[model samples]
Target: MTTVRPLSCPHCGGKEFSFPDKGRCRCLACRSEFLLDETPKPSPARPSGGAGPRRLAALCFLLLLLAGLLYALAPAPAPQPASQPARQRAATPAVTYELQQLALAADPTRDGAPLVLRVRGGLGQKGPAGYVADCYDPRTQAWSEETQRLQDAVGKNAREIRFQAMSDGSLFLVLDKSRLFSFDFAARQWVDARPLLERQPRLAGGVVQIEIGYANEGDALRVMTADGTRRYFYPAVDLAPTYDELRRMVADYRHPQAERRHGFTFARKGAGTSGPQQLIRYAFLDNKTGPRLFGGYLEWDGEGQARHVKRHAHIFRQAHLEATDFFTPDRVYYRASVAWADKEDLIISFRPTPHPDAPSLLQSLDPEDGAIRWTLQCNFDGELVKTADGFYLLQGAKLFRISEGRRPLAEPQRLF
Candidate 1:
């Protein structure tokens, strides 16, 4: 590209001019000349001034050649800024469900506030696939049998169940030889959903176990098995079943046949044992690695591919081994010598049997080694209310703060 600028003669006021090579400009008026020597000049003569004309001519020619070469090599006009490539986005944080409230009322056992249990069971009688869920409220405390009937409780067909409640309110329910069904508490209806392992996943040695965890987002669920395979579930969207591949899963909920096993003992004040809201058998892993988890059913069905799911394993990772024999709903005083160890390992002992009975004996693990570091044995009179500090154990018509630990917590004067 070239640019032109007008040249005028100062003396004669002539407007006409012609541009020449090498920075030179000529004006017709007064015959004025400007920058007529942009071209390279010959190097100064040697100090001795003895160089021949032929030698000087050769030097001048080389200088001119070098100047032409330099001009030719000048950079081309700055190129248009190269189109910037699109930036990649960071991944979303994992989903998690945290506690919103533990509503308490005069008769929590009567629905104003109810205890929450995350469980796993079958969808219908002998529904082939077992599933898991937060089995809403108890039928006894429910509004009425008719209303309760409207609710979708885990049917009898479910043969196996496994559950874990994370620090965040996220609840994981795993089942086997069955599938899951989701309930819309507000709608009093069952949401149409599919089973995650509808085809059931099989594992080596023909053993399988299922486990679930909720990430920090609370939007998705992570599923894991004894075999190290993982899957994720997004509750917000519908899942495409055609994209799923049914893998082999644990064939039965029989603990004797399980590749891994965990046990529990649920008992109340004087009661030997009680039935659980839901029941299912499962294998347990002893460590954070190596052992595989296979077999489990979910509470609801949607996105069916387990491979595509993300398993945040650390959420339910416990540090103690729980006594697994007692699986009941009646017993309040329950002791579980679980798989992991530590105070935060979730090693707890419940007391007083189910509802109305209140908790009596309590135990927790040591945060350091998951050892049974604390225990509470109480003889009280009425109902009970619990908090991190202690529990208000009620027996008969009397209410008392039944506490046992390093420093006994002071009993509050009154509780409405």
Candidate 2:
């Protein structure tokens, strides 16, 4: 903060002081002035006189004569030896590794062992004790029982149980329409109830399914229902999108006649409810300018609200064709032929397929815009697994890597 201030002269008691660009300031009183510091500058060269020019000409002739005498006395340099041909070495090709369906956990505990995938079968009449915790190990290449039913037998209403590894080396299990349950592997005990799934509204027909969406901020599991409703399940926070907007998306885009189920995406910015949250309907492509809307299909903002903002068209334009079944996270380095798009601003991959009657080939669309990015000859299931180099695509048991820049590798390698 350099500031300018007026200075008063001591002699004449004048208030004026000069601040010059090239020199120091001077006081107007008593005509007192201080000399400014000067920098040293190189002096300009002067023209040479006639005597110097003649001497320089004589030196040049003497130098030429000395060079001729030296050349005449010295033998011509021997011809340089013929250069030998450099040996050509063959290029080593990139080593490709076959991607096996290896089990992966959330945390690193065991050394390259299959993850403990626990699944609850049909509930028996044995009460809570009947619930079984079956462990899937890659060493034995089979499911082993780590612990049997400690409590009463589980009820027969038990369907598929969702299992995910926690950061604390614990397994999270949530039965459909049930509360969240955490199983600690180290302590070998069922701790407090980890609420990861949201409760469903009671209807004439019971809620058929509740699939976990992409992971959002705070590591909350975004839950999707058979209907169009979506709920965010973190530790203690709960957020549901607008009911009317979800219903409209289901009726218009996902499940038109109530026969099919619509998809929903939740992208969170930070942890807990304080963070920015966006709930988007997985349907249509459209842009917005304040109240004015544009593009092919209209969609709600990421927060699942009706805020009229520009739908990201740049990503859409890059996506030539879109697929509903894709991997989470847009950038994948697996040896697979699968890629993801921005599902509600979240990363997910998809592959496009051609129509039965139309001759137009299917192309991968950019998430920024609806424009196509890559053309695919065959249909892809979009099952991508992460590997060391890139993501692994498990298509018909053949593993392939989806290279950088959205290009599919050659043939797939057999994992089995």
Candidate 3:
């Protein structure tokens, strides 16, 4: 193929044109400057630095996005082991125990006051330097007016070790020890309060008593905080269930049986082989409820299948509960710290405050259905005493025997 060149300048229509440079031309007759052809000239290339930052910025954004996605998809952390340093953890805010009246099932057989069981929480600035509790003597079956602080209840060392009441008339106390003298009224002499297990407590006698000393579930597994409120993972009850039982339960609930291949277990809930609220808690490590610890109560229907399952899932990253309310209600009860439950009365923590005089809210429920029979405002100062015949709620030094019978709580018999 042959290439042909035009011999005219478009600028001035002159045939005589001269090249001023490789890219440009000029007409000699008209003195007009022009390019060799009508093709547009290319502009100078921009510096690489000009666009480098924008590309770099885009790359950075992609890396950041990837990092965020990885973080979101990560598995939830497991329950922290006891050995991990908690330097990064925020302090657990102190919870004020507003228990002005503590139910003392000191002696149900005798009943004036229940049994005299006195418990005191550490008064962090408001009153006391320690936590202490006492029970009526089993020998005399009487509430001792004087309560001596157990060695375990001193300073802040054992402040968080809570006292729990059992369905049995017997009280359960746990501690390494601040010792107590057991007087045998039948023998009229002081006896050794021994043969006591350091952690596992049982209602051995009519009155709640134990040898004084905090028997650490394991070697002082934790450093005692100044306020004695630091929590540690105690030895768990060896209740890991068998795989066959769990499969049966999961099948009963009508969910995918293959789902049981993952981690799961079930445990019975009740006290000393008694109560209408008996249940089996089916716990599984599921992220469906946001991981952490999620499970439910396996309530069986008349057809022997799990019809209603009550769930228990919460972020317990800070502290472990040594004890919880005895009764689990159908709905949420905000900060429901259950104190005690008997044949007639059920005590729930009212609110947190500094005053010792503020009583906890006590509700009497029908033993048959757990419906609220009545509600009474009572203190948990550990002054509610049980005698051979009735119960009494003590505020300060004054004794107000709890009005008995089926009257509404507002009409609680004003027994002196």
- Model 2 TM-score, 2 decimals: 0.32
Ranking by TM-score: 2, 3, 1
> What TM-score does each of the candidates earn?
0.24, 0.32, 0.30
Candidate 2, 33-120: lDDT as tens digits = 6433422233555666688889989999999999999999997898997765555345544432211122233223443222333444
Candidate 3 accuracy as lDDT: 0.39
Per-residue alpha-carbon lDDT of model 1 for 1-416, expressed as tens digits?
A: 55344445554656776677557667776666666443234454455655677798999999999999999999887769766555534554443321111111122223322333333333454432233233323223333223122224443543444333332222333444233334443443334333533433332232233334332222233444455554443332321111022121112112222234443322222223342212112235332211123312211112322112121233223222222221332222333222222223333444434565565544544433334555655433333434343344433323344443233344422322
Q: How far is candidate 2 from the true structure (C-alpha RMSD, Å)?
A: 34.5
What residue runs in model 2 are displaced by over 4 Å at the alpha carbon?
1-106, 110-116, 123-129, 139-142, 145-160, 163-171, 183-218, 221-231, 236-353, 357-383, 387-416
lDDT of each structure? 0.35, 0.39, 0.39
Candidate 1 displacement at residue 377 in angstroms: 1.8
lDDT for model 2, on a 0 to 1 scale? 0.39
Q: In terms of TM-score, which candidate is stronger, 1 or 2?
A: 2
- Candidate 3 per-residue lDDT, tens place, 1-416, comes to 65444567676667776776897878888897866667344455567675888998999999999999999999999988676367647665664532232333445444422444555554545444444444554335555655545442343332333333322233334343333333223332223333332332321222222221132111112212223322221212211122233223322222122122122112222222211232222223222111012223222222223234333332122122112222334422222233444445544434233345444555554433556765666544544444444445555534455544344334334332
Error of 2 at 121 (Å): 0.8
Between prediction 1 and prediction 3, which has the larger lDDT?
3
